[model samples]
Structures are given as C-alpha cells and as structure tokens.
Target: MNRLRTILFATFFYILSVPIVMSVPVSALFGRRAVIRHAHVWARMHRLLYRYIMGVRVRVEGQVPAGTYFFAAKHQAMFETLELQLLLGDPAMVIKRELSRIPFWGWAAMRYGGIIADREASAGALRSMMRAAKALKAEGRSILIYPEGTRVAPGEQPPLQSGFAGLYRALALPVVPVALDTGLVWPKHGPKRPGVVTIRIGETIPPGLPREAIEARVHDAINVLDRERRDYRMVQAPPAA
Candidate 1:
C-alpha cells in the first residue's frame, strides 16, 4: 500500500507540474513577478497533494523572518526544495546555471530571478551568484541556498561547500540557517516514508563575521534537525553584531 501511495504521489505531482511548466513561457512574457507568483501557487498545490495523497505533512519550527536576507538550509531530499517555497512564499533560490538551461522549468527559474551559479566556471560562478544575490536583496527578496551543495544521508554530516562562505561574505546579509530531517521520511531516491517533515528555522547570523565563525554556526544550525538530537525547539538567533 505504501508503494502504491508513493507511485500515486509521484504521478500526481508530475501531472500538475506540466501545466505549471507550460505556463512558464506566458508568465515569462509577463515578468519575473508573474513567474514567481505562478511558482508559489504550484508549491502550495504540491503541499496539498503530498498531504492528501501521501499522508505527509509539514511542521515549521520558527517564523520565517521578514525582509531580504540569506537562508542557508539543509538539503536532505527533494522535499525541502518544494517545501521552502511554501515556507518563505517566494525566496530567490540559488541554483546551478545548468538547471536554468532546461526547457520550461529552467526558463521560469531564470526569468523568476533565481541566483544561478556555474561550479565549473570557478571564480566567475561565485561572482555571478554574488551579483545576482545582491540584486535580489535590493529587490527585497530573500535568498535560499543548500550549503552542502547536494543532498546527504539523513544522519551524516558534511562540511558546507566553499561557495556558501563566499556568498555570505559578498552578499553581506544576515544569514538564516534552516534545519530539517525530511530525508528521514523522503530519502534522496527511494520509497517515501509517511511522517511530518519538521523544518526548524534558526536565528539569523549577522554578516561580517569571520569565515570560521559563520561556517561553524551554520553547520551546527543545520544539523539540529538530525534524528538523534530529536530536539525540535526553535533556536533563537543571537543578537546581531
């Protein structure tokens, strides 16, 4: 029955995604705001489908802060990617340039002003991402990035990618560290487990901190949601320096 439910969940998401994908071109013609609004609606619909079809619910810990800032979140599975939109309305996502080159989805991401990075481009990629993030900040849109750069096993801990640190220094915005154990129920590639995915939003780490301080703080913040800790408490942000 679980397997069947998983199949149904995947099918339902893809089916609805087609229309959203198709509307991208038209939304692009309108502007990034239009595309972002459409995407927000899609994310809400996705949350509904997962809840009704798969019995998976989302429980957020802390209130998402207002105004433009950086959100450095743990990437467990594809779950958080979809869930973040619902959580933060429509923050500018930091994604790879290759993802921005895809057909409808890519076009929408590019048009919607996602901060695009090209790892292969080395320093240039970081520069491009910083410039884009700064633009989004000016536009009063928050930015979200997976500090690990890719998904890891639920219980495992990995050092954040160097790009995250660079973005922190260049963008100079307070960084909100988010932690989630979605992978416990939604593995990177496997059958879906039924449970509530808890997203714990940590306090905002102020900018201009040394690299070691920021990275260590973010690393601990994101790992708070790991199963062993089992403490789902809201972590208050320290007073900004």
Candidate 2:
C-alpha cells in the first residue's frame, strides 16, 4: 500500500512538473521576478502533493525571518531544497553547478537567482559563487544554502563545507540556522513515509564573527533535532551582543 502511494505520487508529480518546466522559457520572457514567481508556484505544488498524496505534513517551529538574511540549513533529504524556497519567500538558492546545467531547468534556475557552485573547482568556484551571491544580495534577496553541501542520513552531522564560511564572511548577513527531520520520512532512495516533518528555526547569529565561531554555532544549531546522536540536544547560541 505504501509502495502504491509512492508510485502514484511520483507519477503525478513528474507528470505535473512537465508543463511547469516547459513554461520556464516563457516565464523568463517576462522577467527574473516572473521566473521566481513561477518557481514558487512549482514549490507550492510539490507541497500540496506532499500533503495530500504522500500524507506528509510540515510543522515549523519559530518565526521565519523576512528580508535579506542568510540561511544555513541542515540537508538530510531533497525535501528542503524546494520547501525552503516557499518558506523563505523565494530566496536565491545556492545549488550545484551540475544542477545549473540541466538544460531548460538549469537556464531557468540561473535566471531565477540560483548561485551555481562548481564543487571541484575549489577556490575558483568560491569566487564565482561569491559574485553571483553578492549580486543577488544587492537585489534585496535572502540566500539559502545547505552548508553540509549534500544530503546526509538522519542523525549524521557532518562538518560544513568551507564555502559556507567564505560566503558568510563575504555576505556579512545575519545567518538563521534551520534544522529539520525530513530524512526520517523522505529517505534518499525509498518509499517516503507519512509523518509530520518538523523544521526548527534557530536563533539568528550575527555576521562578522570569526570563521571558527560562526561554523561551530551553525553546526550545533542545525543539529538540534539530531536525537540519534548520543550527545544530541539543542544548544542555543547566546543572543548576539
């Protein structure tokens, strides 16, 4: 039965996605904002499918900040990639260069303010990403990044990628750490289970802190929901002085 539901969900999800993906060029014709609006609609459609078809629901704790703040989030599944766009009001997303090369979808993503990072290029990638991110920031858009760089299994907290710190220091925007338990249901490869996924928004950490301090704070804050870790528990950072 669960398998059947998963199949139905995937089937309809991609079928419905065709038109939206195909419409990207038309949306681009209007303008960048129009493309972003189209992307938001796409994200919302996925949310609806998650709720009604997959029997999955989201429960967010704490306020989702408005305006041009930087967001660092836990990445345990592909779920948040789309969901955060809706929750953060279509913030410019930091995504892989590979994703940005996906033909039509890729072109639309760049037009919609995606900062594409070529991971293997190291220093050069960071330079390119910073340029794109700064441009988006100047446009009054918030930035959302999965600091761990890729999805990990539930309870596995990996050190954040160096790019995270570089972007934080350069962007100099307050960072909001978001933790979620989506992997429990939305495993990388399997039938998704029906459950309430909780997204915990941690206190905002001020910008301009040393690399070590900011990385440690974000690491702890984004792992607040990692119950499987023997030492796991929420460690809130003291209010920025």
Candidate 3:
C-alpha cells in the first residue's frame, strides 16, 4: 500500500512539475518577483501532494522569524528542501553545484535565488559561496542551508560541514537552527511512510561568535529531535541572550 502511494505520488509530482518548470523562463520575463511567485506555487503544490496523497503532514513548532535570517536545518531527506522554501517564504537556498547544473531545474533555481556551492572545500568555492550569499543578503532575502551538507539516517548526527561556519561568519546574520524527524518517514532510499514530520525551530543564535561556539550550538540545536541522541527527546532552549 505504501509502495503504491509512493508511486502515485511520484508520478503526479513529476507530471505537475513539468509545466511549472517550463514556465520559469516565462516567469523571468515578468521579473524576479514573478519567478519567486511561481516557485512558491510549486512548493505549495508539493505540500498539498504530501498531505493528501502521501499522507505526510508537517507540524512546525516555534514561529519562523520575520526579516533576513540564516536558517540552518538538518538534512535527513529531500522533504525539507522543498518544504522550507514554502515555509520560509522563498529564502535564498544554498544548494549544491551539481543541483545547479541540472538543465532547466538548475536555471530555475538560479533564477529563483539559489546560492550554488561546490561540495569540495576549496578556498575558491568558499569565496564564491560567500559572494552569492552576500548578494542575496543585500537584497533582503533570508538564506536556508543544510549545514550537514548531506542527508543522514534518523539516528545519525554528523558534524557540520566547514562551509556552514564560513557562510555563517561571512553572512553575520542570526542563525535559526531547525531540527526535524523527516528521515523517520522519508527514507533516503525507498518509499516514504505516512507520518507527521515535526520541524522545531530553535532559538536564534547571535552572529560573530567564534567558529567552535557557533558550530557547537548549531549542532546541538539541530539534533534536538534526534531520538537516538543521548537526550532522547526534543529540547527547546530559551532564546539566546
């Protein structure tokens, strides 16, 4: 039954994605706002499919802050990647360079304000990412980045990529750590299960702290929902002073 639902969901999602993806170029004619409007529509449609067809629902704890913020989220599955765009009102997403090369989708991502970062930890790549992030910040757009750099199983909590710290320091924006249990339902490989994925927004950490301090805070905050962790439950800390 789950397999059937997955198949149906994927089929319809792909079918629905075509026209929207193609329309991105057309949206560009109307300017960036039109492109973002179309992107938001695309994200909302995916959410609807998740709720009605996949039987997956999202429960967000804590309000998403207003204005520009550095959103650092856990990467457990593909679910949050699209969901965050809608939830955060279309922030500039930090996506991999590979994703930015995918023909039309890549073109749309760039057009819609995605920051492309190479996975390799080279100085040049870091510089390039900072430049893009700064550009978006100047435009009054928030940024969403998966600090772990890749998805992991529900129980695993890997150290954040160096790029995360680099971008954090470069952007100097308050960081909102987002924790979730999406991997429990949306496995990296295989059909997704129907369940409520809880997204817990942690307190905003101020910018300009040392690399280690910021990284540690973000690591713990983003792992609050990891049941396999020592805490074994969600821990919502008070807002940072």
* Candidate whose lDDT is highest: 3
Which TM-score value belongs to model 2? 0.93
- By TM-score: ranked, best first: 3, 2, 1
Q: Write the per-residue lDDT of candidate 2 for residues 22-85, one digit (tens) a residue.
A: 9999988899899999998889889999899899999999998777899999999888989988
* RMSD to the hidden true structure, all candidates: 6.5, 5.9, 5.6
Q: Give me the runs in candidate 1 sitting further than 4 Å from their true place.
A: 227-241
lDDT of 2: 0.89
lDDT of 1 at 85: 79
Decoy 1 TM-score against native? 0.91
TM-score of each model, paired residue for residue:
0.91, 0.93, 0.94
Question: Which tens-of-lDDT digit does each residue in 1-241 have in candidate 1?
Answer: 7788889989989998999878788877887788888888788888888898888988889999888788999988888887897687688898877788887788777777778877664887788788888888788888899988888888788998888999899888999999998887888776886898899989989999999999999999999878345443224445569
lDDT of model 2 at position 224 = 85
TM-score of 3: 0.94
Per-residue alpha-carbon lDDT of model 3 for 1-241, expressed as tens digits? 8898899989999999999999899999998889999988888889999899989989999999898999999999988988988887678999999999998999999999989878787999899999999999999999999999888998898999999999999999999999999998889889988999999999999999999999999999999888444453434545569
Q: What is the lDDT of every predicted structure here?
A: 0.84, 0.89, 0.91
Which model is ahead, 1 or 2, in terms of TM-score? 2
